[model samples]
Target: MADRLDYGEGTDAQQFVFLLPEYLKDTSKKMKTGLMFVKLVNPCSGEGALYLFSMCLQQLFEIKLFKEKHHSWFINQSVQSGGLLYFATPIDPLFLLLHYLIKADKEGKFQPLDQVVVDDMFPNCILLLKLPELEKLLQHVTEEKEIDKKKYYKYSREKTLKWLGKKVNQTMAALKTSNINVGARVQSNAFFSSHQISSDKEEDYICYAHGLISDYIPKELNDDLSKYLKLPEPSASLPKPPSKVAAQRQKRNK
Candidate 1:
């Protein structure tokens, strides 16, 4: 019964279905999958939805699909490829996969079965984490004191990667059941001097960096990615203005 479910229903759904035959035919084709590394500044803690998702994937996918050679290449290539540089932050691996999936889906290059594959593995991926929780997690990490900065950053990065690996494993495990060969690997590259992490402008810099990656993504996938990433929406409530009485009191004092 689960095999009959059609998980593709958005604007580009039909295009994905149309591409399935090609993927099926080229089952033996080997393509080098690349993950451009960017450190995540804030990550959801505890049983944070994204963290849980990552944990699941690591247990299920990465353990099975990722080969040593492929993993090495992914990390090595990013350093060689060269692009806009930014400070490394702790990022969930599943989030990275989702980003790639969004890019492929938007290009109409992803197969429908692949969507089903994602659904089976991460049925509640987006639902698990709320926007506020995600935002708070980032704030918590970035707001740490300078004295404990290195320790906090290391802890966050390790924890984030651990969960991410789990998520990748889970996703791959689900794909294996469908006879799909899916995999994930870790990659790291040297940070460029031009992309130094500035303390004062970190927030805006990170936001813009994420936007740059999102911009290159196809339109169909952009909305979904934004939604998943908790990007602010136009209809979201604006912050309340200062009280008139408080404003008047301050003016009088001045």
Candidate 2:
């Protein structure tokens, strides 16, 4: 006779155990039952796979419960009128299930109970399971044993040095052309001035001097001077040329 079957809530809505049929326990009738019992007791190998499978089953069963509720209310209406039903949205859970299944299969646990529960809940659940492409990419990275630290450091250092050199060259070139008195004597005179220049006037004088020097210096000479200093390239790009319209207006006035 079939074993008396009883289903009750476990710790959570998803947690439940099924009492085996009496025939399943009869070792002479089925050797598969013994194998299944052993697997149930020792699930470490396929734990991840089973966990994911169970989650999917719970989600799918929840969807089925909603479908049943809808059916009860809309008995007169068509099943299609119940609206669309999704076991899990956001796609993450489905992907996780697929990942675990792949791992389980790789580990050689083909008939995991979690997988069984998922299959029982939705016969077409395999259709929903998708291969995680990102997981495949991650696996490739994880499987690689060797890392080229020296090559990485070499490239990083080269890039950093190139950037720093460019900035320093520019700064030195600006300092060379500036009227800020780099010479010790001039700097001392400026610092100990009995009649100091006003801040506004000093700024105006610096700007005017810089403009004059910039106008007088040839492009080639400026480049050579900058190269000699071995400083970083300038932070500021050269100013744009005067507009053709402005130039034409100046020529007309002349």
Candidate 3:
């Protein structure tokens, strides 16, 4: 797959290699318009980011680009530049909805989900409300009040923190199960840590898990989660996750 192209005439046209959930392929066979890509507000950064919305499945997937230097793909006797790969992974819709809910909280009033999730920048955010069990998911992060058979919701920081804590715990458990050495202070651009920590160091697992979770949450929320999880104080000098480190390196190259 990494073979460099050296043969015949190659077009300057760009080629993208994508990795998507296998289920989407079957869904595509029946309907085409149901699956599409859109730019939506990134919950963590509030910036425009690519997302795949499945109107058929009422699901959302996060889109990420993977690229590296000195890499090429030989495709049907043509060379493709940039050696870029795109990934589409399924994501929880609530994480994206939480961004708007927290913002709407500034008003400190219970409102319908429709009003709370509106985004002028990325109007497609409304599609989130269409996801199944939104009411159930919202219950995890918001306080709901039913009046005259209609439900209204308001963001509850207490509940959100608790939910985030559960997420941290889940991530920590996965890290330990996978034997990841997130406790080490060494920096390397690989998934495996260069330095190893004892498996018994539970704190390391928590801190490492927090760092991974930090990628999905805002800085302020991440700080709050750090305190919630009772991990060590965060320091900027610490090494970031391999994916984040690679992204920073790519940004610098650009």
**Candidate number achieving the greatest lDDT relative to the actual structure:** 3
Task: List model 2 lDDT by residue over 40-82, tens digit each.
Answer: 1101222222211232332321111122233211122222333
Question: TM-score of each candidate?
Answer: 0.19, 0.16, 0.76
Instruction: Evaluate model 3: give its lDDT.
Output: 0.69
Error of 1 at 43 (Å): 15
The TM-score, computed over Cα atoms with residue i paired to residue i, of candidate 3 is 0.76
lDDT of 3 by residue, 143-225 (tens): 99989988999998899999988888998776666555654554535444323544436766677667777777778887888
Question: Which stretches of candidate 2 lie above 4 Å from their native place?
Answer: 1-65, 68-88, 93-132, 135-254
Off by over 4 Å in 1: 1-132, 135-155, 182-254
List the candidate 3 regions with Cα displacement exceeding 4 Å. 1-33, 70-82, 185-188, 193-200, 235-238, 244-254
lDDT of 3 at 250: 43
Which TM-score value belongs to model 2? 0.16
Worst lDDT 10-window in candidate 1:
181-190
Give Cα-based local distance difference scores for all models.
0.27, 0.29, 0.69
